[model samples]
Target chain A: MIPASFDYVRATSLSHAIGLLQDDPDGNKLVAGGHTLIPTLKLRLASPALLIDISGIDELRGIEVADCIRIGALTTHAELLASKPLREVLPIFHQAADMIADPQVRNRGTIGGSLANADPAADWPAVVIALKGELELAGPTRRRRIAARDFFVDIMTTALEPGEVLVAIHMPRPNRGAKFRYRKIRHPASGYAVVGVAATLCLRDDIVSEVMIAITGATSRAFAADSASTHLIGKPLSTENIAMAASLTGEQAECLSDHYASADYRKHLVKTEVSRALASLNGA
Target chain B: MTDHTEELHVVTVDVNGVRRTASVEARKLLVHLLRDDLGLTGTHVGCDTSQCGACTVDIDGQAVKSCTVLAVMTSGSSITTIEGLARGGGALHPVQAAFHEHHALQCGFCTPGMIMSVRQMLGQNPNPTESEIRHGLAGNICRCTGYNNIVRAVQSLASEAPRHD
Candidate 1:
């Protein structure tokens, strides 16, 4: 379980991290929280020459609620759970944060690290994709923003380019009368989601003004259930319509099958979890 | 390939209210640094993959899996292991006393982590319900005792008036 030895350098600042990554052409990896990277390293699945510890970078820490909720990349899950502003403004983040692993793991797991790690079963992806969050990235040359929908490319893979570091996560303010929920069937041993669903609904005068349903742990990566969301929009929030929408989840995606659960079972779970999420929102 | 062992990083950490500095490899986990280097073996390493909470320790007042944290990453932070729970090495901490009184632990492999986790839980919510205690201890697993006495132990502590400090 011992990891491969590598050089460790704590980045003093955001730009310094990018500069170190640029200077080290021998696979320099940015580590935050080390919840995901350390395990991978111990497994010897990856052996980088240098590890850039961005956990110490003060600029990459804290939650700022302005026009949007700007969450620094190094903000831990414990911080997210404890944020009073997040709990009042966007309770869904707290809901998801509460279910992420347990207290010990959550104390060290970072939102940016989770998003960048892109674990198929990670809870943040479903919530971020459903909330339409944006990821801010900084590189040696310039900085750019990537939508959550496009940030996760595949399992444990993201659109982060070489020498690029994820700086923050930007989430638009939830619309008025917006109700959100995240429901998941977690694996008993690891606490990872066997199937997770996050739903955001904007209801106006009892009619669904907007809806977004993101499904995770059932496909290669977390993705918006377009068919489900489209079906629920402009329709009255009813059990029948919610059931219809829930059935549409994972319709277009290639559901994953493994020792944890079968593809058919996971697809079934997607429908069940989506229905439960929608039902909870409807009841709210 | 370079000889990675030749590269050692000096880390200064405050463990159990004591400041200690050590030279460790870049890949040295915090659990190994505490047990192997600082001689604080109370933090047991059950599952190094961060699944089991036997390696849990308080890092900067937060419970974290030490096996998943590199020693170099926690160089400047304060860490509290199971050894730090008692004052003046006299009596067990309140949580530890509760566990002992309730017979919460059968085999002691997971006791250090369980005690540390409960200490944190009680710190946050001095009076937690039975369900809350179960949820709080989800990260720490115990093969023996079946968690009945463990829940009772935490419940007994909660039944007492909330104690601050």
Candidate 2:
């Protein structure tokens, strides 16, 4: 598939990218991995006048593993899956990365592109939401941070302002005693999640101290199952309670339907995968 | 070499141990650059939608789907195609030999891309189990239903000396 002709400029630095976007926010689209944007362009779904290539920026790469985890927006899925420090600190990342497209796609598709694109089936939003990540945005004038919970608006929509670019994601490492899990039913052809659920639970003295659950691929946008999560807090960590919470997932959101899966089936997946994810951590 | 209405980009790359440069349009795909401009047609394009791995090639050290990659974005990178797999003496790559010995192909249309992906999997993990091999080859589709032999071919290499990718 061939894309329409468009002007391309490689952004030399983060500020350069911000400046380019600020100059032509509506006409230019920033490309890091180009895995998502190039396909959309090839299909003529989007035809911007210019493309600012942010893949070459040195500042938008690497993972910092300290008390607070910092991940560059351009960090590829392979990098996340391969980082021993990241895995040791947060296993949810590699778990989600492992289920993301194939090895070749992972080698090229960046986390920033995946999140910014806001593809319904993309895995990072739910993972970030469950882990309570803080997305850092850089604009021409200033920098701001937004919680992952408030970042996503809808499919292909984000809270990012015009002329702003997502630069990094910062989040405190989950407590050492906490357990995290991400589970998904993979679509055979596309490798996207039919329905995916990411959950984090901290159990102390046989009681749930903290819990977060986010469901993706089962709604217009990824959403935190706040009711379900709240139901589990201060309760006994039991399979029955887990199942009850899983049943509450996607209770408010309307799911999207396509040739691959129906909305009803996706709803079924939310409950199934959530229960499975929570059950996986039941013994731990 | 020629530009008309669209803006052109100057891209340079090392392919099959040779450094080559080409001026292409901003929309040109890496697969076309290799086949049309650089004359390395061994890298096939089966599914242009990026689902199939026919256009798989080694970019730097990663096996990437060339159809999904823009030529201009890959400037200054090293790319290796199926044509580069043969040794200096024209000997087939060990994976290719295994495929040939095991009759791992039917129509052979997916052979080059499949081999490239297999080389990548083996490069990452010298000895992968049956399920891992299957999972690793999930992205590359062989329509001839020759997956059994292909799996066996990959399995046969596990007993040999570790291949340095």
Candidate 2, position A55, lDDT: 91
Q: Compose the digit string of candidate 1's lDDT tens values, residues B18-125.
A: 999999999999999999999999999997788779999998888888999999989989999999988578898888999999999998999999998998898888
lDDT of 1 by residue, A107-220 (tens): 889999998889999999999899999999998899999999999889988999888898999999988789999989989887889999999999988899999989888888
All candidates: DockQ: 0.67, 0.49
Q: What do the candidate models score in CA lDDT, each in turn?
A: 0.89, 0.89
TM-score of each: 0.96, 0.96
Candidate 1 accuracy as lDDT: 0.89
**What is the per-residue lDDT of model 2 for residues A101-194, given as tens digits with 9 covering 90 to 100?**
8888888999999888888888999999999999999988889999998999988899999999999999898887889999998888787877
Model no. 1, DockQ: 0.67
| CAPRI quality level assigned to candidate 2 from its DockQ score | acceptable
